[model samples]
Target chain A: MEEKLLSGAELVIRGLEHLKVSTIFGVPGGAILPAYDPLYDSPIRHILARHEQGSGHMAEGYAQATGELGVVIATSGPGATNLITSLNNALMDSTPLLAITGQVATEAIGNDAFQEAYTVGLTMAATKHNYLITDASEIPQVLLEAKHIATTGRPGPVLVDIPKDILNQKAKWIEPKLVDLPGYKPTLDANPKMIQQAVNLIKDSKKPLLYVGGGIIHSKANIELFDLAQKFNIPVVTTLMGRGAFPDGHELCLGMPGMHGNYTATTSIQNSDLLIAIGVRFDDRVTANPKFFAQNAKVIHADIDPAEIGKVRDAEVPIVGDAKSVIKGLIDKLGDTKLETSNWIQEINEMRESYPLTFTQDEDGPLKVPYVLEELQKMSEDDSIVVSGVGQHQMWISLHWKFTKPNTWLNSGGLGTMGYSLPAAIGAKAAYPDRQVLSLDGDGCFQMTCQELITASTENIPLKIVVFNNGNHGMVRQWQKIFYKNRFSASELTHHTPDYVKLAEAMGAVGLRMEQKSEVKDVFEKMLEINDKPVLVDCVVDPDDMVFPMVPAGGSNDVIILNEEDLKKI
Target chain B: MSERILSVLVEDKPGVLARISSTISRRGFNINSLSVGPTNIDGRSKMTIVTELESVEQVKKQLNKLINVIKIVELDPDNTIESEVLLMKVSINKDSQTSVIEKANLSGAKSVDVGQDYAVFELTGTSKELKKFENLMKPFGIIEMIRGGRIAIQSNL
Candidate 1:
């Protein structure tokens, strides 16, 4: 084989291959034509999305699924601008993504020349780091650095703005030097002394509890956290972000605690003498009326971010380190020091037995959302990834879904951005082809990002989508029903929807809709039969059903509503 | 209460905002509004945090002990040199015009614009100097003031 030099565009394709980026989703334009020309013959498959936002989201999905850095390429101007929302999405969620965009020629930049804008400057606040490649020679190093930055530490989106001329310019390029960031070092070791102190607090306490959050997933510390909890024999309560962190069915696991969390979970936190908060940020949402949260508890927070140690609640034994490493250290120091919490466990069980998540309906009424989630859980594999759109569907999935592994459950917890699912599911499916990626979408949110189905179908990513179609923004409607005296207002959606099955067929995907309770399993089974393409299951759910045990905004977690009888039980 | 400056390096991740902010509140530490930016490193960030407390040293030591924290360097304002920049617009009257411009020159500041009613002066120096100048120019009639959030660099390496 003859050794040959490749152009900048060709080198980009080669670099993506080296980085193991198999998919490139974007919409092409004038400025990036050069790069797209080379993409055709390149091994990297390009997914033409309906919108640039969808492309960024697809890349985000890929990152979250595989734990690899996601990649997206867009052209200049409007093409670049369209990615802002998705970029912010990745930024806010701390997702690992690489967004590469074509820019005008270096000389033409700042002349207000055509589509030339300071893409790097424009994206400064939205990205971890961005580079404006004025020199074609810098592309390789920039690409490598972008990948490195996107995947390292706490993972975020990094952008590389390549000038149009640089992509077109031909030069004898020696490989750029690989530079080590001298200041970049993430600590993994937990100080043994501090770990022992924390363990002592737990062992000495009568009613110690564990408060888990998203940090467990972010740091991949679920196994370690579970082991520590089991060792201490402490009751566990999770924040909204920490749902599925522990097996929901685990004896020690007391569902989500905080505002809008279960009564038992919140009550357990309040009564706890020692709170072992692991990798959890006590957000105000999670600590509604924080003055009352765990009033009896002395917190021992172990988090990687030091700044988070005392932001919301004071920590008696604050261990600032990686959750996995710190928890492991705590376990080692624990060394079989089992604190007897039989009474505490009994109390928690009492709460669970009293105020559990339950809903009632007639045998012939509309489809219930919880049952849909339950059925989906039964149908999906243990390793399947579940993503949800915001609103009622998000709560249903969070409550019903039991996640066993890190990165298996994806939702916009912090930002709570609606219209998140369809695109995110596409991204997840692209990232993990072998694993089933399910998007649990609400009717309102599904419509918002439904256009991405075209991207999913065209790219041939087999995503399993379950839409809880109640024909309304069920959460807002529930709020209106509870707080606003059921005035309805603008919450009820009036727009008629396209027949989803026909719509899915139009996008080259298989769509199944279930109107009755009996039809649910068969429709899901039939959809699963088509493993070659994506499947959309639009289950018509009861518009009247609302998420139970919801703590109204700004209300105490203790102030919950669980139908009259359920309330009496608590 | 004594105050101290601690430079903390953290995993440049998104949720870090929650982690860092919550930590300060938990410790009963009042952060005087911090500034963060990317370091030379690919995925790491440096935060210049200001805290007022008697246990400044304790805060620094505890900060350095954090897992995401790569390093913590304490820069004392009393022992170390520091400066701040302000983009202030001052109202200039014809009667006190020359005096105001002369005062600006003496402070090593430059006036970027001069209008019939007002003028804007950009000053870069210590917070004390900026405050002193702002008081001195009050007689000339003050206009709107816009301050660029502080970016600090330790003078003594």
Candidate 2:
């Protein structure tokens, strides 16, 4: 028999436990202190993050690494406001995240009360859906709805803001079996007419290309995209977020295209006769100049969001439906279409060979970021997840790490939020204890959420955080060196970092530092051997390193700054 | 192509017009036309959007997923009655004020005020009626026009 007595906070915590949430990242404050009081005795582990944003990112990382929704709790006002960046990141990346924040009491709302912010309005754009729970009785339903919206179709973050009074009020906790919202229904089928139209266009084109994005991963349609690509002998180019959909090792995988993408990736799109875009919003980053993005290609943009179908470029055929369904339909209809085995493939191959991702390591200057990623990749499992903090390290991980599954590679794609990796790694490890969860972070991002390392150590979630230390926001410094005429504006950060080994020991975990290129392989081997606790590897890297082949944001995709030009020649 | 109904909730702010219309332009989903109005609450409004999508099933499903949209539902076209409201401000010669007022009343519109040289007329009904009123006042030289967004509700038995 289910008991019916619990405060809103208890209901929320109980519901989370029922939903199998073992860990929650948060910071206690005035409005949310009530919820914290009850959490002390709960089975759910509450991690006290130094900042609310760190907690938000931890939730995001966990959700992105594991398919399970990431849960974060924050107090009202600035705590809630700080979460905006992480929320924005989740929204942009379509990660499954659930963020619950304490709200000022109903009486104090709109009265400009302390620690009060318009969280609902602030998070509306960044969440798939959000609710402000004013009634304590509605807590169960709201929690259910929040998780449902978050994990359902093209997964994304959702928020539920409960006022302090509501959290304090006792209510009958009715754990409903179903959420019946008449207004919410997600479709997973392609529009037949649009599919037919797309099929017809693909059928007519000589050189068709499948431009895949993160949607393929979101829909778990990598097999389908790969099948369609091979079915039609089409080359596949992924956006930055869409990496890992097709292995770079595969000949069919053309590599990432757009600003900062490989030449072949961008050129393939330009030269292709027909472009079939799946589950990707053609952001300005992808299409620096829409006019030239697919100049010679007839575009057929397929996305679940109707508004994004042709938002950036003209679509010869726009299909608004789930990526998996649409791609399946296309594959079904692609029978007997003649394969165009043209030199377009040759051009792509030539570019890939000409501009491959590389880093020199001949007893080289500082530690190499790529070498660190390569070592980690070998040590990690195919199913293990890697989340990245924003900056040079983020770019390097996306470039060098070989991921094999959906949610295996998580990064703040849209918002580019820094300090996201560490906590997210902790969350991911907690969510899926069986899998290895690691945050490949930069020093800049590591410091941003390093306080959560203590959380990781205390919770005993065996998360591995490999911090690529360059002593600066390496990406911004690269930008300054290239674009801003080397005028570094607050791009450098310095604080006496506690000896990380002692720090991890202090926090009840393992910590190792790698100063030389040779030191990394041995240190990483040793770290992997000791899986008893969380580990942090402070990897010293080249300070002036830049993520090369970057077609400056808003610049032409075909135009790239070669790594040689940026590093060796310059 | 099939048709679908969508309910879009937007921040009731200026230039939301440009955002909505521009979205339509980008998507190229033919708008059969839509009706909108303010809701019971302030600073929030709803739109009853009717559009010809390639697939009714797909459109209905996708409409529910938009992050900016607060809520969406397919109105049973068989049972729901929809309407649009329109408002206009016209500057007419002082001598033609009486004629304009008479014309306004004939079009089921009320000339709510008489200014030094202009009159603001308000009308609530179908878009056809509003268009008719606009055409009737065309000779008087319309100075400004405002059309409320689309809103709809199911008629009770």
Candidate 3:
């Protein structure tokens, strides 16, 4: 067979196709034009985003929804720089993303030519690994290796910066080869000793609580986790990122635990005798004050990344392996030995009954965000995806919405990036066209990336964006009110707020506004009925409403504030 | 704070040093000294770093988390043969030349070059011995001095 010559640009597209990349989200510019020209002929569908950041986040949303590697491309300098936040978000959340940026011509790189940037240097810390391809011949191998690195072992964002000259240069395509990474092997199976130690802990503990995180969804270990939880008769408390990992409606579900989490979940963790921390990093949000967090509990931590095993709280039994494999090992090791925890379950249920998540609503007063989310949850199908931006509305969705499937609830749990819900919903909707996609966003968050709605409208992605309009950065305002002598500086957006309904209409989408409780169910139903175009609902929620049961910043989990009186006492 | 030495094996690639150093600094660990060179393995380099042991667990976990880092082994000073190389050009007068050469030879230093005004001597020893040698040479008006960071190998014997 004759060796066919292909340009570096064509090889990039070919590499993506070989990796089975069905879609990519990116924007085109001068330095990246060579690659974009060939993209026109590629089989992969390209989603043109209004901003580079939006494209990066859309890629994340796609990855989060589909459990596939999301790809994003951008030009050099500003284009690459714009992706820093999105990359950092993906890094913190362990989203599988591959970002390709175009550099200036190889000769012009160090000379600071037009649109040139040190993209590799910029993205080094934010990526799992990064590459600067100096030669055209290295394209195919580098791309394949980059994909492998991005999606494997603690999945994260990876960047490949190709110079313009390299993209235009011709190179002979060899058959795809295995990635040459000796230092990058991740342990996929838990060690037998560690698994046995964990099993012993499980068997001995009178009170065992399962603390699950996003890694369960990443590794698709929900079934194994559920099996372990049920067979051992242990109650489970999920982190914010772990919301959909276990069915929220399950009898053993203690709901999300941490800041803005339910009372039962946080208290149960604090009082448990043993904590089986699966796929969780013991983030400060979950741990609150490390000094007092799960102080009574002996931890058995299982994760694929060894770095997370003892990074925060020390684990008595540390298992470094894939979540699914480790959980499977635990299940196999137990061998039908049912641990007794009936009293613990009864105590947890009492806590759940005593401190159930609740809110007050007046018949004619402003609508509550939680009420809207609860109504939305009731209206949507069980498998519908709910993507949320950061703030009070995010907490509301996490608290009120019932997630029955894994990978169906996407949020910026680690980075807490605002304006994530809109573009993310677009990507999720694009990935699963038949499934309903909802963006539970705040007014402040909605304004940040409202421009991406134009892309949603133009691309015909029917995402239902429900703006929880509290007329301010609700979380910041709540914090200021509690901690900063009520000095609401630059937090309120009442006077300068744009009419989201009109804005959504301007972007060629159906716009609806609901200020009363009566309109909530009808508007949500109407929004769901519109399958031809995207819809934005400006839900006027009470501005004074705060996410309760918050463990104040730097405060211990035992110091949770359930109401204004609790704040006053503090 | 207790001082410790860490031997790290890393992929010999561009920007790895920066990656490791930045991660260390960002995590608030002050690196006292770091040295990097190619090892016996192909496409692999060894980095010997000395730092305080206040956050050894965090530092080790963070360093090990990096994809480029192949392995990390903490060398116990009590069980390892650690050495650092130092080169110094000392100002030499007739009065000080004989004394400096005598002290250098006693300290296992070899004269690399001798000039009209100064003589360059190369010394390799433990960090403590090198420090003592440095102090001894300082009185002779050292013109230039450079010391490599410590490197270690396990002593099976």
Candidate 4:
């Protein structure tokens, strides 16, 4: 708060501390080494990650769990480029992530010096906003502006590329203030007139369904969504990103709807007369051949980002606003009115009964992946945060887990990045040490970023991680089995090299292996009991088993493949 | 394709141009012509982009999402004063020199340079007029030609 001379690196650490940032994730290198010197003395705790990408996802995990800005730092060139995946992941999922990279000195920037990269150029499309700083005097304001931009109004990733010279430049320090961004104002509240029109459409519809997405969790509108659905007794179907936005076991909830969505959820979407979409982009995974998706439904789309409205499915009534404000507006304007959705609800319930999500567990066969998911969720507390990696296990968690609280379910939804579970779960545990954190990942996805388990162990962040090891890339084999005439090429994951139990022990974490379905409950119980360090469980299973109730790509929601029987019929 | 001109105002900063152009291209919209210049307002710039994509509304909305983009408006061709500068060099001898100069004068073009075997002329007008002049010089075997892309501003009534 005083006017004092400070180096650029000190200014950065001081500025972050001034902004109330207590934790950060990063990897140090030549360009970023100067910033690390100041960070050494700062009160902020910087978790050293093995890879820059890991640090970025850890930031994303922290941001999503706490509803705050997740910060990650790296050096230039390869270090900065490695962060592209995590930055893009945050961009797609709308997580507030701030990425700071150290560049070469100003004189060496254009000379192709060692570790110099055009980071700002490379990350232009990968971030929500970005900046390149060569002057030390701009550090304070740029730091403040970067955090503000990354955290507000349709949150996404922002980056600041600072030259190494700037990190050593001495400059007068002043308390940075947030200047209004004229071009960056976001629409928070929809027009009342538009809300009235949406209300009118809900009143006239014979069958109305609430289609929720991750935006509901981002906007903290779960209660409003539930109240609105309960008032009308409307059916609710959540997307993969919207898994925890609504309780899965509610009488009106039809579970997830999309390519791998439940049969009832998909059918209800096709048969609905009205679809009230909230905080969703109508991603192709959900819409599936947009022309044929929800043919009988008129859509009312609401989201914080205006560009998302009608981007995929044309919305008859577009409400451009945050989910909480729009849903609250709809609730207040509709004013305790109950709709006649009893017959509609009964029709969907019949469909739900005819085709529930089911898989047979053989007496002496390979461990079922879904069984592991259920056991983990059943053993853990209801409020335990769930994280997942991209593959069959990710879909299994979505299909099996019953999330009762918002922000409790985390995964790489839009980007679908593999190996996201371990570091992200560590991030969640870092944000909320009191809450239990469990991550479900596949054999293929777990190896991609499994090195981060060392960070968890060394940092003393205890996380229960389960790897459903089918000894191959499970999802690809399933697609090959169904569509590629059973020719499994490059799918075996090198015959499961590098024993996972040893890998866990080498990483300073407890290792548990589940080779049978009978060991699931005990393995999970023991995994939960360990609180001193992270624990990894490898549940070996059958590779032939695949995710069912799937609508093939470019197929209509009306056409769903129930099981191998349906595929054989094809 | 029905063509539309989008006039966009953006903050004067590095990488803003790349952001706008990339956003347009990634949306699968092809730009016909784009020109940028400093505006009267400090720390702000304006870009004139001509595209014939099916949905100008889609591109406009996408650009608005960029943090550097201040505002965007589609200019009405009827009320816009669109113009460009054209320079043309023609191969000419003693016989054709007089005739080329005559024709250039008829179109209000000024002869900027004259060589023993070639003549250079300069003109300013809308694309339609400059295109007509290009054709006229083609008969004389145009040696070279250059034209500044179109720029427009609304006519204040």
Interface RMSD of each: 8.3, 6.2, 1.4, 0.7
**Selected candidate, larger lDDT, 1 vs 3:** 3
Give candidate 3 regions above 4 Å deviation: B91-98, B111-119, B140-143
lDDT of each: 0.77, 0.77, 0.90, 0.89
Q: Where is model 3 chain A poorest over a 10-residue stretch in terms of lDDT?
A: A494-503
Give the alpha carbon lDDT tens digit for every residue of B48-142 in model 1: 77777654555664455333467777775656565567766777778878888889879877899888878888898766788887887777777
CAPRI-style quality class for the chain A–B interface of candidate 3: medium
Ranking by lDDT: 3, 4, 2, 1
Task: Decide which is better by DockQ, 2 or 3.
Answer: 3
Query: What would the per-residue lDDT of candidate 4 be over residues A1-570, giving only the tens digit for each residue?
Result: 667788888888888898799999999999889999989998899998899889998998899888889999999999999999999999999999989999999989889999888999899889999999877888889989989889878999999999999999999887798888879999998889999999999999999999999999999899999999988788899999898898989998888888998899889999999999999998988988898999999999999998998778788899999899999999999897889999999999898888889988886788888876777777889799999999788888888899888888899999999988888888888999989998888888888999999999999998888888888899999988988998998888842576888999999999989888788888888898998888998888888899988888988888899988898655
Which pairs clash in the backbone of model 4? none
Error of 4 at A249 (Å): 0.6
Pairs of residues at least 3 apart in sequence or in different chains that clash in candidate 2:
A58-A423, A58-A424, A260-A551, B35-B149, B35-B150, B35-B151, B36-B149, B36-B150, B36-B151
- The TM-scores of chain A alone, one per candidate, are 0.92, 0.92, 0.99, 0.98
How well is each residue in A473-551 modelled by candidate 3, as lDDT tens digits? Answer: 9999999989898899999897235888888999999999999999988998899899999999999889988899899
Model 4's CAPRI class is medium
For residues A503-535, write the lDDT of model 1, one tens digit per residue: 888988897889887887899888778789889
